[model samples]
Target chain A: MTTTQVAPAPPGTGTDRPAVAVRGLVKRYGGRAVLDGLDLDVRRGECFALLGPNGAGKTTAIEILEGVRRRDAGEVLVLGEDPSLAGRGWRDRVGVVSQGEGAGQALSVRETLDHFARYHARARSTEDLLAAVGLQESAGSRVGRLSGGQRRRLAVALGVQGRPELLFLDEPTTGMDPVARRQFWELIRGLRADGTTVLLTTHYLDEAAELADRVGVVAGGRLVEVAPPEELGAALRRETTVSWLEGGARRSVRTQAPAAVLRDLLAVQAEIPGLSVTRPGLEDVYLRLVGATPTTSEGALR
Target chain B: MTALHATPAEPRGLERLRWAVADAVAAAGRDVAHWRRQPAAVLVAALFPVLLLLMFTYLLGGGMVVPGGGDYRDFLVPGMLALAMVFGVEATMTAVVTDTARGITDRFRSLPMAPSAVVAGRCLADLAGSVVGLAVLLAAALAVGWRPGGLVPALAAVGLLLLLRLAFLWMGIYLGLLARDPSMVVAVQILVWPFAFLSNAFVAASSMPGWLATIAEWNPVAGTVTAVRELFGAPVGTGGGWATEHALLLAVAWPVLLTGVFAVLSVRRFQGLSR
Candidate 1:
């Protein structure tokens, strides 16, 4: 009997070790340090997002990891090889959809995808890629004629043609409409399901919450905090606020188990006054963390 | 679509070379498709030189005089061919700078293609367009009763013109990489017209006054134009100077030197760009 797995898993892949690993990475421009000793790790088959404000070193860090830019000092590894020294073999296993990047404007969308497709020995068919990115209707139009969001989707389409094990998407949905963003999320989900490890950089809070397995809040050239979207920050995350009236007095208590408290309260009486369960949402904690860290200097210097 | 990559390891031997060639060809083919998609732009680009050629032949031909006895049209044809080669240099630089500005250059550098493929592709694409432009100008010259003489010499003249173009493209690549923004290109574009006209590309260099004539003779464009004129059996610029007298030698030497210098500068610039 033959098993059907469309993606041919490369050797030495599917390991327990993280897909991306960086330790004390340092990069500077002029005299100012843009990335001052940043550390990060992205697990295999997980979507890790570096969420930050403008000039939080998110783009610089990602660029260094992608090997488009070099670091001043420190150890960095992607797929078990130092990115700066990695060869074409490493490139074959990694895909990049860089911000502000687009193929030739003079060429049609299909032609643009086809040109990039030729670089990969085993590439997705242009038809499948066009359909996947929802650009089939505009496949015949010149890249210059496409809208900004349409062009971005084409960039995403080109990035995934090689079926890379590790995909780097830098602000991939920055300009997409709500509907297009939803569609793009589905495409990323498909890649995640197929075991692709993704590293994304975005300032869009919802985009990060909707996709990232874990989000790292970067500021002051460092990751101030990192956790899953639902548990990003704050001591209040695990605690639920249980408020009610005890006898004639208004009372409130924060505890890990609101259900147990509610059951006990119901046993005491038929109804509890001002009964409400409240917990700190991811947005509340995120604003508190990112807003508190200083990232303004990086953008100003750049 | 099935295999993640062609090989688990870095492609060795023939596989590497095959893909390298494929990447360069694919990159070049992108430009070809661009022309096919926008025939109007291609037509305008191809016709601009022909318009200049026709205008000079009819408009200015009657009033002009070659130092040696020859029809002005005959002299202008070869000069224009060499000058037209300089025109494509700006296009190459614009392409390079635009790519850099759009982050397209960075994207290409991140790919798994051969190191030289990007430059090679641009050269191939520009060279392809240059050849077509040359052919159109030659046809226009023939229609205007200007003969470029025998096959052997004509082909050699075409070779020198293309060599001049190759030299300029390397310079374009270096400058374009440095500019990185389309807005910065206007200064160079404005300067190109004066640079082209200051040579013997339009009127004979000897026709200008003493010091100016000497400068025109030594102009790199003048050397190629004069050499091409000699090859086409037209009147060569008779200015008395080392560069003027040594047309054929300077024709080959200037381009070879320019190509060597700019290619090195451009490659070094590109290597340092990502950092």
Candidate 2:
């Protein structure tokens, strides 16, 4: 948080710089603002998860940071350069795994990686990249024939082939099976271990809890709250629920003093059956911030 | 912790050019692989003009005659060659639209590659395919008793045909970027056939009505058709007026103009995607 106060320097000249820093970013479509004066900062070597509901300007903010969309007003310094005007040198340092297919349908996995490798000055080997993404077996298969998970893996491979310092993953595991998703988490963990900065956007709250060092919740086109997952839950005023079975009926009470309630219950009962204490989890805090009904399936916190 | 690596400096000057050319060739190689994998589609694209040549020469040729008292096959062969190049617009448009719909174009745009390399690669691939397609049509014409009078003019005629194809190539790219999907491309393709037939590719412009002939004579396809027919020693009717008489000038002018306009439009549309 202290790092954001420092003024951004010229491209490639800043010391102790955040990987991505934005101040008062704004974007509009036909007089309606999609990104309305938002601010965010992602420190180097940290995995920052941006969580938001649909139409909450998450994609717009990410695209502006990636230099794919022009922001109407803002001071954005991504990797020490204004992304909107960054040259190829700056782009080489960043990688993006978009929520879209790769560039070639007829091209095999190897061919596709090789083609993208040429874009960077020091690209990783296609063989190693394929192995990293677990697509070595499908290296010879056309992209059109690969399953959805395989294609997503291929997209990640292409993103990291340049050994980028910053990687942007937008809904990276949308169609992957549970096992594949865990495997992807391990891959991202490896990238983080290598000191690569990752900025992730996902609807999955568990994913955000599991991967992010800090989570920023965006709603109504602005970041309403940002903190570590536990802190985000603690910041919310939701009461802890203490429940137990007493006299053949279940009894429940919401209270801020759940610990005292549990102590009194324990002092009264020699053996209390089916006793449980439930505090607000990350999902509850996220739902509260986004102003959504907890029962809604769309953009589920889980 | 894994070691963090800094991005290497960008390639400068000659090295940049080397990388750009290599990337462009890589893109073209993708088209090569596509052709290898889908040889059937390539064959169909290459042979479609031959079917048109045969249908016109055998079925429609019997009832039609050249305006200047010559073989309809001779006039039709050169004109069909020009028409074949024009017909390639649909194929190029279809490929571009498919790429866009499939999100391939957007992927390419997100990379750090040379901005022009992808389009350059696409143009090179389609142009190479057009050249081969022209050769196949030429062979069919030769088998049907058409002959070139001179080598130099024939080569020049081929150049003009390819130039015309290149112009359509940009137009296709522009339309492809504008189109929503392959279905939209199909809708546009239906219009290409009707547009192709209205030109002076089959019959002489002079043989049509005064107003129709004037419009047909001024059709960009008419310039290439007339220019190629003249170069191939086929009968070119005496369609008067500055536009028809100066067919060669228009042949060159039309492609250059179209290329200038549509290439700008394509690049603008491409760059505007981010905006």
For residues A23-102, write the lDDT of model 2, one tens digit per residue. 99989998898888899988878889999999899888988888888899989999877777665667777899888876
User: How close to the true structure is residue B98 of candidate 1, measured as C-alpha lDDT?
Assistant: 84
lDDT of 2: 0.83
Alpha-carbon lDDT, every model:
0.83, 0.83
Off by over 4 Å in 2: A1-15, A243-253, A259-276, A294-302, B1-18
* TM-score for each model: 0.87, 0.90
Listed models, DockQ each: 0.42, 0.40
- For model 2, residues B1-275, the per-residue Cα lDDT tens digits are 11132234556679778878887887787787778888898999899999999999999999997776888999899888888887777888888888777767766766777777878889989999998999999999999989998999999999999999999999898988888578887777788886777778998888888888888888888889989988998888765567778999999999999999999999999888877
Interface RMSD of each: 6.4, 7.5
**iRMSD of prediction 2:** 7.5
lDDT of 1 by residue, A36-125 (tens): 989998877789999877888888898888887889998998887788877677787789999975588888888788888877757889
Docking class of 2: acceptable
Number of backbone collisions per candidate: 0, 1
